[model samples]
Target chain A: MEFQEAWPYVVGVYMSIWAVLLIYVIVLQNKLAAVKRELGSLSKAVERKG
Target chain B: MKKSSLILASAGALLLMAGVYLAFFVAPDTVVRIDDRELVQFSQKIFYFHVPVAETSFVFLVLGGLFGAMFLGTRKRSYEQMSYAAVEVGFIFVLLVMITGVLWTRAAWNVWWEWEPRLTTFLVLTLMYSGYFVLRSSVQEESAKARFGAIFSIIAAVNVPLTFVAGRLDSLKPVHPKVFTLQGASMEGPMLAAFLVSMFGMLLFATSLYIMRLDLLRAREDIEYLKEELEVG
Candidate 1:
């Protein structure tokens, strides 16, 4: 069988896998950034109180 | 990323690329015997990645359940974090498995979805774990959330075996192929090699992701603890 016939399905499967994983990685990164910001603010508040 | 994790990730990426190349170009195309006719199947190539991803998901879920059990026994926050991270990672792999499986079914069986035993049970397993997240969010108290999550995780883990065995029970005409056996696999030569490499690559990728997620969770917890301590001081 020619690859052209099944190319769409193949591409769809591969692309979906990569896209989902990429989305996860991006979400994790965003979360780490948000946590860092929160930690910075908390540390500054502690310093001012001390 | 840590140096070791970076190396592992790079190796996994290279192996996965090689596996894909071998699956499409090096491995010989397969033919399926159906109704006394041999049909050349191009979509069987998806098996290389699909099986590995499915297996990875199963491994992570089992680990998640194990950690959940440990959390219940020890009441350690770390165990709960590990359980949550493992389940989160497993969810991603499960999503991939369903997407690829659907595509394969459409290509091979000429149907997008069916109420087959394996398919139905797997869907149930997915829903059960998804409910775990919902359960966690619903509980406001830390101890209550962890306890409920642990109990649900164990129950969901028990369902894994049922999901796996559902298709093999009667075996009169299962759409899912029983390829792996106790002694050996059914595939041969290049096809088997490609599958093995892909499986290794996927396991490595899953492990690295799990470690990264666990670290992130721990860091978040540490920050929360520090904030609490500072407020107390």
Candidate 2:
């Protein structure tokens, strides 16, 4: 196939791979942050109870 | 642990970027001619990332099954968590492989999808592992969930070989090229080098991600333990 015709598929594959990885990373980061916040609150609650 | 993970992540990122650069600029383009028309298969460049990610997914799936088996034998929470994380990452990589494979198929075979053996088996493999998560969430009890997930993961791993051997099982034509053999790759020098670099980069990246996910899961578990202690106090 011509470069013009094939370039789109190449670009699509590259972009999709990166986009998926980026999304997964972002989601993991958010989950980590949420768990950190929960840990903080739990620690404070435990301290007060003690 | 955090410092080491950060180092791994940085190195993985750098290697991945270098691999991408090599794929686009250094690897030689494949040329094909059909019906008196000379065409450049520029889409072949996708092979570098696609093959590596697909292989990485298989590796992660195998690791998941290994950990699952260990969890079943030892009844350890840590093993189950490791198994779960590996399977999760494997699922994501497999999804990317499917998407990229479909795109490459469209470019090469002029079709979005086919009912070929390899393709069909791969889809089945994905679905089987996907059931792992479904089974995990459906159960309410912690021990039951772990036991079920571990069993399913081990059983699901059987599909990996099925997927890999699908193309070789029959006389059916396969668009997916068998690049590797006992004699090494059928590609040119630069192309093979690019592929190797990309594969290494992807493996490193996947490993880093797995470590990060495991750490996060451990942290979450610790938090839960603290929460329970706080409530009791």
| TM score of chain A per candidate | 0.83, 0.90
The numbered model that scores best in TM-score is: 2
Candidate 1, B140-161: lDDT as tens digits: 9988998898888878887678
lDDT by residue (B1-233, candidate 2, tens digit) is: 36666677678778878888888888878888889987678878889889999999999999999999999999989999999999999999999999999999998888999888888889999888778888898999989998999899899988888788887654767656788876877999988888888888788878877987998889988998997897677
TM-score of each prediction? 0.92, 0.94
**Each candidate's root-mean-square deviation in Å?**
2.2, 1.7
How accurate locally is residue B135 in candidate 1, as Cα lDDT from 0 to 100? 93
Model 1 chain B — which ten-residue stretch has the worst lDDT?
B1-10
Per-residue lDDT of A1-50 in model 1, one digit per residue for the tens?
Answer: 33667778887888888788768867876776787788888778887878
What share of the reference contacts survives in each candidate? 0.42, 0.71
What lDDT score goes with residue B43 in model 2? 79
Candidate 1 CAPRI classification by DockQ: medium
lDDT of each: 0.84, 0.86
